[model samples]
Structures are given as structure tokens and as C-alpha cells.
Target: MKNSSFIRKDIFGVPVLKSEILESFKDLSHGFSTRRGGESPAPYDSLNIGIAVGDLEENVKKNRNLISGISCSERSVYLTQVHGSEILVIKNDSSIPDPDTVKADGVITDCKDLALVIQTADCQAALLYDPVKKVAGAVHSGWRGNVFDILGRTVRKMAEVFDSDPSDIRASIGPSLGPCCAEFINFRTELPEALWAYGDEKCFFDFWEISRAQLQKAGLQADRISVSGLCTKCDKDSFFSYRGSKITGRMAGFICINN
Candidate 1:
């Protein structure tokens, strides 16, 4: 992600992509992880959080532990990420199901100090926060999720659960597939017709703009959104890319209501 006044590097040395907009909200904490800092080795390199991938179980454990320390939450909730529009709700109350058992593409939380995480390689890990309601959401938006409008659905899901209006929510689009590398040889069969306008000289689509349009369609103001335009495929040195390599580590995007 490119640096700007809206998004700045952390002085804490976590090597994360943070949003100045989200950072300004005292009650919340959120960041997108880069491949720079952690314990995984070689291909997993460092900070590989996806457990389902071929990475060692112990390596993933250590990586997750490092993330837990960064968020300062006891544990962060993650979904199975089915690439569907299903939304998992996490209440502030004490009782909640095991997050791993929640097979959904997105998570919504009104809970404090409980981190909500999204795992991704070449897909967008979109983060949403409502300062008015002190609610947050993290979504894994792959092309399939995009076809189903997962980001927009998650916004409305927060409204259903926490009474959060999109106008009151601020968002950050984490790095993922960019237009430069989102080449689709058969977009006519793979992507919907509505998204064809963003196609580049080749068949590559600009998913970043698609995300922005989806968020705006859900009622979030243009100024309230901050997009990290970094393309995971283009920046392999900083992030994991499934398209870049079949075997690669997964980076993370995190959100929580600070205690």
C-alpha cells in the first residue's frame, strides 16, 4: 500500500499497512499485515497466518500468536472463508461460539478487545468500522465474494446486528489483486457483465475500484473510505500472493474494539 496522510506506517515495528482513518478512532484497532515480520520460514517466509495452506502447524501457531500480541486481544476470530456472502456475528456478550467453526466469508463484531481477522493472499481483506456504534467487521472478498457482493452485504449485516448505518462507518480496503495483475483470459465466463467497465488494456480488472463502488453502493461516503492501492501480485516482497505462486503464505487484515 502506498503511504499517505490517510495511511501511515506504524512506529511500533509490526510491518503492517495501517489506515490513519481507523487509527484516529481511539476505541478501535486495525491493520493489514505484510510478509516482513514473524517466525515462518522460506516459502512461508514470515508471518504466514493461513492454517489450511501447507505451512507447518507450529509455524502457523507462532504466526497467529504474533498477531494476537499485535492486536493485544486474547485471540482473534477467523472464518473458514468460503468465498460466499455469509456473515458471522460476534456479540459483546461473554458467550460466543468458536470462531473457527464459523464458516463464513465475513465477521461482524460489537465486542470489545476481541479481534476480528480476515485471511487473504490475492483477495481483498476489507475492514469496516462504525465509530458511532463502536462496531467493526472484517471480510474476505475473493472474486466469488465480489460476484456476490460480500462487502456490501457485510455492511448491511452490521446494520442488522448493531444498528450501524453505512454513513457512520469508515472503511479501509487492504491490498489484494490490483488491476495490473487481475488478468482474466475469459472474463466473459468468469466475471459478471457489470464489472467489465473496469477492464484494462488486457482483461485485467481493477478490483480496488470495484470495492469502492460496492462500498459506496452500500451507503458509505466516498470520503469515508481509504484504499491501500498496493497490489499483492505486484508487491511480493511485502505480501503473500496466491497468483504469484501456488504455494505461498497468507497475509492478514485485522480489526477490533479496544478495551
Candidate 2:
């Protein structure tokens, strides 16, 4: 299923997953990183792109640099994702700041060569690109993000800031916790009533469908949206799953307008 929408490639020894939908655009460069081939040791084994996940800052920095190199990004913005509705809009190089100080779950930019990066272990990293407006966005949408509708907010942000029409945007939902492994036993107390309907008889929720619904609600065309259908928790050898291992490393999903 992953091969249908994505391609696996080795970049500087790191395994990166690319979306064929995004790859069709010659002006963009994007990929999702796997958890192998980096400088970090166990728990983080290698390629842990997250700095706040208790990994050594130096190792994380190297891993980040490696991913940037793999993506051909002149500059990469790694947000301190809070699973909130806030979406940072970058219109020019002047608007760029130290991303370490910026806290947001999603980021959009029209500037070329500036890669929008979202680090995740099991959360969905939704990458959106509007060829009409030449704008790109990356959002970190976990369960809390779903509650806040962060993806919808991101699409709105792109529209309000970059004049991007949701219909003209092509979006892709990357590898995350699939419904088969996403069991929420406490759904009665944790999730909202509306969200409970998306769960199965066993309390397993389909977050991928939830993301698609949110995107459609934001006015995106159904045909333009792509889902990787790769489950992180099920395929532990290829991805990092927070639910599977509490002390595991994090993978990265990146998108950039080529310079």
C-alpha cells in the first residue's frame, strides 16, 4: 500500500519515504524519514530528528542536518509542536525566526528553499502544497490535534495568508498509528462524542480517516488528498511508534519549495 502512494529511497544512508503526489511537482522536495542510519545510539538507534525527545542535542542536530541535506533544504524550520491550532505563516525570508523559540503544530511558507519540517513518532504529519499559489505547509496532527482540528486550521491559514484555495491544494497524510493498532480503551472519557463514532467495536480509531474528513471539511478536493496507509505501530522495523515503545526515536516528515 505504501508503494502505491510513496517510494522508499536511501539518502545519505538514511531511509526516506516520498509521496508520489508531491513528487509530481518539479518545484517541490519532500520526504518522510525512517528511524535508521544516524549518529544516535539505542532507544534512538539512529535518525531521531526530534530534539525534545530526551535524545542528545548534538545527535539530534546531526540528524536534523542530515535530513535537511537529504531534502536539499537551504534552511529547515523545526517547530516546537504543541498539538495546537496555531499555524505559523512564512511569506519571506525576513519573517523567518529561530524555530526553536516558536511553538506551533503547523507551518506554511511561500518562500523557496525553506523546508517545513514536522517531527513525529506516531502522529500524522500532513503535508499540503498549493501549486496555484506556490505555497507549502506541514502540520503535526496527533489525537489532540484532531480534537482541535489543526489540519482545518492550517488550510484556513494558507488561504488567509497566502491566498491559497483549498481546492487547488494537494495533501498527503503520512505514516502514523493505524486503526488496527490505535486502541483507545478510555474513549468514553478521552475523546469527544462525535469522534467516538470513528472507532471500531474494539475502540480502535481510524485517525487517517479523521484527517481526511478534516481536510475535506476545509474544502480540499478528495482526489487530491493522499493517504500513505502505512501503520507505524504495526511496522516497527520501518517507523518509530511512541505507543509501542515509550523511549523510542522520532521520524521526520518534510516539505520544501525548491530553490
* Per-candidate clashes, comma-separated: 0, 0
User: What does candidate 1's lDDT look like per residue over 21-125, in tens digits?
Assistant: 788888877888898787888898888999988889999998888788788788689788888888988787756678667789988888888888899999999
- Compare the candidates by TM-score and give the number of the best one: 2
Which candidate ranks first by lDDT, i.e. highest? Answer: 2
Worst 10 residues of 2 by lDDT: 1-10
Residue 60 of candidate 2: its Cα lDDT? Answer: 92
Residue ranges of candidate 2 with Cα displaced over 4 Å: none
lDDT against true structure, model 2: 0.90
RMSD of 1: 1.5
Off by over 4 Å in 1: 5-12
Clashing pairs for model 1 are none
TM-score of candidate 1 on Cα atoms, chains taken together: 0.96
